[model samples]
Target: MTALTIRPLQPGETDLFLSYPFPRQPELWESQRDYVALLAAKAYRPEHTWVAIRDGVVVARACWWTGPEDKRPYSLDWLEAEPGPGQVELGTALLRKAHETMRNDEGRKPDYHLFLPPGWRDDAMVRVAAEARLQTARNVDLALFVERYSYRWSAEQDGLPDRSDRLEFRPADDAQMLVVLRQVLDGSLDAHDQRSVAEHGLDRAAELQLEGLYWFPSPRDWWQLAYTGSGELVGVIIPARNYDMPTIGYIGVVPSQRGHGYGAELLAEMAWRLNDHAPGEAVGADTDFSNVPMVKAFARTGFRITEEHLVLTDTAAGK
Candidate 1:
């Protein structure tokens, strides 16, 4: 095996390092350069991007960011390495260099995360991660691709039943939207989400621009709350666009209101509203894979699993 020599990418090396992703079809350089430029524009430190250079050729590349504009601590993305005799070793070394650069040297280790595509789960690079002890965090980030959508378009996919005549469904303005957003996230979800919510409330979470990051049509509405004959927040669904598809961003029935099928009804109502208001593509959303109730609720309303995601975490050294 060839020895791996990984280090921080130097200035002016962008063109060369960016071209490494495409051994052939170097035309990809245009798109790749655009992406690198975007990251560089917002990077807290220019050295965040790293490259593994061996024998004067860049073999691996990983983009890194710290305390990016949003509340997100840091992120590493667009990681790719060439298929070479020492690619795995080179990639691991490059990753280690990144960790040390941010966490050790810069003291910026505020729980960074890497979202690896499922196809790379069993790669030698991932094996190095496990040996380094970066514990896999809670919740798989499942997704349903737009292409695999199998649910038939139905008119029944619109509006909630006025069963509990006392409750009303009205489009919410930004001010009225605050109330529904308050209870949007229940801190009881998972270790990761819980920690996040516990530290940063829903308002702060929203400020993270999760919705803005998604491609969705909006003028999002906080569907009127469901109250019984006696007014109370029984159920609520805040629907919006995710990748321009009808996305149920937040739907919850107070624990006291569960088991009476209110959760399912709220989801159904949201689906209908989205179909009616934003009648273009499809409706889709994601919940933790373990959230059987939420998953089942979507399924009952004609949504299906279209993609699987595995969330992996590893130590700085790839343990």
Candidate 2:
């Protein structure tokens, strides 16, 4: 039997980080690289990665990520094992070690999180956590893809059905945009689509679902704002294309504006812009499974659930 050890990655070991390989969904894989690059550019430290090498061969991999200002200390993003005996043990060992080490770090006691295929819901690691009485957080990652569902969209969908009498649409400037975003902060949390920016207390998990949507590297021009004729901002749409494929990112409406059918309008407009700017074979978007209104809104705009994902969080005691 070959022995395995978990340790921090050396500077030159980036090439052996073959958790993402060529033949398997290259675009999304490349997008992960792009996302890592973006985080580095934003000054995110590269931590929470470990490799299990046996006889000079890297047979398993596990990794996590942290957000700005060290919030959400450990977020597990990817985990994989090359086929072989004891692969799961190797991978799971690396995961436990990585979390344990991060918990002991002096800087902060951050939360550890992982996303696994639904089948792993009963994995031993989960059982260990239960036995240890560790805090656990759960959320879903809903998927929309063209492969399994037909889509139909138009500017005149049920949500934004041609309000010819009262409102105008325009690209918002930074100052005006901030005001609109501030209004959205409350609604954002209410919708479970924002991140917890607060520190030093029990952090609300409301924004957990919105993390990916907000993290995307979409330019400002891709965002659109809807306003009343008198200039009262009602809603906003962040129509970002995925780095890997044709897709839309976060879209939100203020609570004060929800019943006006603005949500569907924003989705349709975003789809229209995506169709106009970057035509592709298909488009994709994701939502939290618990977020029924948002999911239903997407479905009304012709999106269907294609895959399911989970965002798991584990809180480690501070050293």
Q: lDDT of all predictions, in order shown? A: 0.51, 0.51
Q: How many steric overlaps are in each model, in order? A: 10, 2
- Number of the top candidate by TM-score? 2
Per-model TM-score on C-alpha atoms: 0.57, 0.59
lDDT of 1: 0.51
Q: For model 2, how does the per-residue alpha-carbon lDDT over 162-211 read when each residue is reduced to its tens digit?
A: 32346567987665665565556664532123434343112233234334
Residue-wise lDDT of candidate 1 within 168-214, one digit each (tens)? 56555555455554454553343344545666876775444344323
Misplaced by over 4 Å in model 1 are: 1-18, 21-49, 64-74, 84-87, 100-167, 170-187, 197-224, 228-230, 241-246, 276-278, 282-284, 313-319
TM-score of 2: 0.59
TM-score of 1: 0.57
Residue 159 shift from truth in candidate 1, angstroms: 14
